[model samples]
Target: MKQVVAVTSKAQLEAFIDFPHDLYENDPCYVPELFIAQRDLLTPGKHPFHDHSPVQLFLAYDNGKVAGRIAAIFNKNHNAFNNTTDGFFGFFDCVNDKEISSMLFSKAEQWLKEQGATSIVGPANFSTNETCGLLVKGFDTPPFAMMPYNKAYYESLIGNVGLHKKVDLIAYRFGEDGYDDKSVRLKEAIVNRLKTKGIVIRPVVKKNFQAEVDKIREVYNSAWDRNLGFVPMTHKEFDYLAKDLKMILDTDFCLVAEKDGKLVGFALAIPDINQILINIRRGRLLPFGLFKLLFGMKKINGIRVIALGVVEGYRKLGIEACLYASIIEAYRKKKYKHCEASWILEHNELMNKALEHVKGVPHKRYRIFEKAI
Candidate 1:
């Protein structure tokens, strides 16, 4: 018989974190997340999200062996900001059995309902601010950095459990001979024109990193306020994330636009470190894993533009295209093999059009599912 149990012990939590490694042992496209990072994110004291919200982890067992795992999350800030009583389930992984999957979902839903949540929505690890969504398409290629990947049967498994599609997040790919370069070709002219208007485009200054991060945080919060499910990240939360991103950040792909010394927009792309993590043997960083990360960085040839936005008042000034053009131009000089700009909302026509204008092909589609509690 299959049974669902709330994760309470440290041993059970480790089992929960390691379950996917065992399940996808032979799957080439499955990249094991770094053990320490996942542990830190889920632990209350280690992550800032837990400061304002609560999350419970659950694991399903079949005859003493792990069958599935999920997290039932209550984001106090998300609910308060959006004025809705919605709970979330994230960090979901499971076997192919429908019964186990259903049991897990039932447990999550029961907890959410008891928490007074009227609806449950996710696959979101915590919130839309973090890694979320189930891979409904583009399973052929491994995920880029910070993107989610799952079994092809997940769509049916989730649907069978009563969760229906809420929104589709698109991932676009720009690779060798694939990117639209009209923007890049006109980059010089674009910058020159904007310069005449007192807007200067430049690379982020690593020397003043903290100050720059603070400014970018402002732009980030303001730029994305109107986006679907977007709740402004708390100060501690943004700082925590910025600290992590600083490790792999490249100045060439991190650009900013300033007019009269006010930060108006920014774009950030990081080298696709998944290439190294995929070889890290269960996401360990000791006993030669660190060496692989250090040595492997030099050989990585792909980048993921994870964040790019301009403040509302600055939107139509061609800053968006210039940012995309600048990143593409940097990619060309670096001779990178691939680039991905991801998790774009399907209904975001303006941003979607900007990407399509640059020959970015929408290659992957991920879905966020919701069910009434």
Candidate 2:
């Protein structure tokens, strides 16, 4: 028998978090996300997201054995920001069974309908500001830091529940020999040119970290404002995320474009800590996992160019290429094996071309889906 139930208590919530740990146990490519982080994100008062939105979690069972889990989310900030009553389904995981997937969506739909949603859209863990989209391609490799991964049948399962593709997010991979170094070669020249225009590209100042975050937040909100479904992250939300990433942040990998000593653009690449997390069973850091994390992080050989953007007035100023070049130069110095520049909008012509210029290979594709509720 297949059954679905709302996650109402701590035990049920723990099961909800741990379900994938069981489901993907045998999969070699699966990386366990941190338990404490997942717990905090799902808990109301622990994450800043809960301050502005409501989310309901559900778990499905087959013959009393856990089968799947999902979260139905209504983002007040997303709706108010985008002016759309679109409910989101995220943290979705399941067996290959089609019926259970349908039931999970049905429960999500029921709750979303009560909340006045007109369309169901996602695999957005919460929102586009965070990890969103279902992995429609690239199941052969583990995901980079902060990226979602899933089974090959996920596309069909979600489609069966009436959500069809809305957009595809693209991830590109680069390696030492494979990537073009034209941007890196021209970096110094580009920086000099931008210097003449009063814009300089340099590493992020760790000493003024909070102030630096505020400036980058300004650029982030402004730069990505026109993206599809993008909502400006609240101050607290960005800070919360920054505080976490600070542990893995390398100043060399974090570069900024400044004009008149104010941030005009920024690019940040964090060590691909997933490289270590993949070996940590069930994402636990207690017991022996803590030592692994502490020591293993220094040995991580890859990075994710997670964010790169320039505010409107600063566009077409070679700032973008310079940012990429600077990061690439840093990567070469560190002797890293690979870098994943990811979750780029498929139709973002200029950004796509920039990566393509550097011979970035599109190795993975993720999709956002939607259905009228």
Candidate 3:
């Protein structure tokens, strides 16, 4: 017999977080998310997302064993910003059984509907601002830091539940020796040209990080407003996310473009920490997990240029290329071998072209699914 149970107790919640560890135990590509981080993210009052929104966790049980888990999320800010009644499902994990997957989706749909959501979209662990999407392609390699990954069959399970594809997000990889130095030189010239117009590109100022973050948040929210599946992040939501990223943020890779003291563009790249987390064992940092993380930092070889945006007015002035050029140059100087610039919308031709121009090959893809309830 199969039963779906809302996770209301600590034990159930722990099961919810730990299910993936067991499910992907034998999969070499699987990287377990840190247990402590997952717990805090899901726990109300512990994470700021709970201050304005609601998320309900559920577990699917088959007789005495846990079969799956899901989180039914209602992002008040997302709905309000987009002016729609769309709910989200995230932190999804399930066994190979279609019956169990269906049960988990049913619970999520019912709860979302009760919250007045007319449609459900995701696998978004929280939001697009955070790690989201299912790896629909490129299963041969492990996922980069903060990226999502799952067995290929999970896509079929999601489709079986009638969730249709919303959009495909792409990840492009650039090898250290593969970047076009001519392109870099050209972009450097353009960057210098922009400088003559009083436009300056500089590393994020650590001393004024909060103020800088505030400005960057404005650009982030506004720049991505028209993107597929994008929802403006509320102040609280953005700050919550920024706080977490700050811990892993490499100042050198976090660059901002300012014109006349107004922030117009930004690019952020994060160290690929999955190499360390892979050894952390189910995302634990207890006794020795901390040692792995602390010592592993210096050895990371890959980077992910996760966020890059140029505000509307500032577009087409070589700002985007400059951001890319700067990061690629930094990677070269640091002896990093490769980087992934990812999750770009399929329809974003300009950004895609910029990457292709710089020799970033499209290597991985992810998709978001949606269903009208």
In model 2, pairs of residues that clash are none
Model 3 deviation from the true structure expressed as Cα RMSD, one decimal place: 1.3
Q: Lowest-scoring 10 consecutive residues by lDDT in candidate 2?
A: 175-184
Tell me the TM-score of each prediction against the true structure: 0.98, 0.98, 0.97
Residue pairs with colliding backbones in model 3 are 34-283, 35-283
- Please write out the lDDT profile of model 1 over residues 43-79, one tens digit for every residue: 9999999999989999999998998999999899999
Q: What is every candidate's alpha-carbon RMSD to the true fold? A: 1.0, 0.9, 1.3
Preferred candidate (TM-score higher): 1 or 3: 1
- Candidate 1 residues lying further than 4 Å off, grouped into runs, are none
1-373 in candidate 2: lDDT tens per residue?
Answer: 9999999999999999999999988998899989999999999999999999999999999999999999999998999988899999999999999999999999999999999999999989899988998888888989999999898888989988888889999999988678998888888888899989999888888889999999999999999998999999999999999999898899999989999988999999999999999988898998989999999987999999999999988898899889888888889899999899997999999889878888999999999999999
Candidate 3 local lDDT, 1-373, one digit each (tens)? 8999999999998899999999999788999999988898999988878888899999999988998989999998888878889999998888889999999999999999999999999989788878899889999989998899998999999999999999899999888788766646888689789999899999998889889989999999888988876777777777877887888888889999999999999999999999899888877899899999989999999999889998998898988878877887788889998789887888889888877887879999999999999
How high a TM-score does candidate 2 get? 0.98
